[model samples]
Target: MPRPLMHRRHVLQGGIGIAAWLMQPGARAQVAAEPAGASAADFWRLARAGGCVFLMRHGATEAGLGDPPGFRLDDCRTQRNLSEAGRAASRQLGLRFRDEGVRLSAVYSSAWCRCLDTARLAFDPHYPAHQIWPALNSFFQGQGDAAAQTREVLQRAATLHPPDNWMLVTHQVNITALTGAFPAMGEVFLTRADPQRPDRLSLLARLPA
Candidate 1:
């Protein structure tokens, strides 16, 4: 059977310029040098030391442009969905995390389908009922109430007893708002949330895309 044609409306809608941003020579170099030490143990050790939050962008999607002017949040089926590559990538990321024995106490994601899908495929089995944190939504064209939302999420994550590690799957703008750096697809930014110095977070690592 022939595959159904993909429509522009069905294109996963979030940010459109990520590929161009990532393709920049400097950006490519940054990503290339972003990963931590070769061994998974090294990555775990880094995650443990700082008790940082893992902020990730959604996996690849079929969307070619930003959301339409009248996009409705409740009707995801009418919006863009994950591409085959994206679905595979999400599963692979989950497998990698499992193999690495990364302990995640909480899983949070943006309300967008791509982010939600990534969180579902990547961590739902381990951390059921992944929470939706709207602040983690994409900041396309840098327009949104992302900063306030990010602060609220960070505040909540900090108060968790025993200080368990958290994984937040969000969009570039939300991640950038918190870290002052734009993350590529599948990239993760680890940072500590300290109220005394709200802006004193450190960049532990930028996971591979």
Candidate 2:
């Protein structure tokens, strides 16, 4: 079974609704009741419990929308890439998980340079398998492609490695399409996929950068 599909406009509108709720005072308290350090500790503890997936948008990118003219996936120089600070952030993220004893069973990444760089820097030594998951690719250039890509990503999430911590390093559009929320750069959305419904997932929490 799959959850009902939403149009792109509807998805973006729903995301806006969620963003509004997160800005309210009451919602802020619900997200974290303790100090920053304590809250982070609690976040990882839940993550360590497994049966969840970390949908991570790539780290900060160089100034640009999508990619520059004539961008080539094989060439990082041609693509909008990770800034120096982005690289550092990625490394720190990996260290956080390692220090907190979160075992990442698998790491899947988009083939884009920024995405690959983030995963490599953050989860290196534990190499991530990069692939061209259409669901994670940009559809800004073509509206007709969005629905297919969204479906593919949802399906993958529904059946990827289960009962363990897994990760997907992708772009904002991809994450937004599946989760109905626009995650910030380097932000991680902890999600649990519904076993009975491939298109449905519950957003557990947002791990800020």
Candidate 3:
């Protein structure tokens, strides 16, 4: 049996809490391929050529949903953070990128501790991950300024071209909203922004975590 084809419209219709569904156990193992007729192999080949942005959800975090009340961005203890397994997975992910010989032009991360940690632990020492503030923050649980932040991220991505891949370590909601796909923890998607349509993104491939 073949998987159902995914249309751009289908992704746009993914309603609220889509991010929550993606966080379920075994979620990371679920592979979302290119729309039925698209060639998966070709997507990877293009991705390696570096003409797109890589949207990455942070690695697994300690047990929790959203954040505890009064969470502070500067305080890791007040927020749900990465577990040891998550750290190991992040490191392995970085090695995988290295193994692929993917040269990144820039790596940006949300200010949230988990995102910052993921980018640093995984891509640092090779690519210095920089903070892009709210550009990649989670807005699912009523975080404000999501629209503005997303616009900023997309705007930055549009200016980039080949031989330079931009990797953004962000939240699931943000990724879903942009590309209409809910990326699991540690999942990375090679995506290209539609210059004419700033709100739309074309998912090229699901890079192994």
Task: Give a tens-digit lDDT track for model 1, residues 1-209.
Answer: 22234344433332345454454334444332333443445556766653668888888767566566666668776555667887888888887776766677888888888888999998887655689877776656545654567668667656644346788898765665566566666766766666675643445566655
RMSD of 2: 9.5
Q: Which segments of candidate 3 are over 4 A away from where they belong? A: 1-16, 19-34, 37-43
> Residue 65's C-alpha lDDT in candidate 1?
62
Candidate 3, residues 1-209: lDDT per residue as tens digits? 34344434334433335745455444344434454544546556776888789999898777666678999988988998988978999999888778777888888888889999999989986776565667788876668665677677778788889888888998887887667677767778888877776765778777544
lDDT (CA) per prediction: 0.66, 0.69, 0.75
How many clashing residue pairs appear in each of the predictions shown?
Answer: 1, 0, 0
The best candidate in terms of lDDT: 3
Instruction: Write the number of the candidate with greater lDDT, choosing between 2 and 3.
Output: 3
Every model's Cα RMSD, please? 7.6, 9.5, 7.3
Q: Rank the candidates by TM-score, best first.
A: 3, 2, 1
Clashes of 1: 1
* lDDT, model 2: 0.69
TM-scores of the candidates are 0.73, 0.74, 0.80
Q: Give lDDT tens digits, candidate 2, residues 1-209.
A: 22245446445643653565455334434332212233555567778888677889898766566678888888899998988988999999988888877778778788788998898889975434444454566554442366677677677667755457778888766666566566677888887777765654556776776
Candidate 3 has what TM-score?
Answer: 0.80
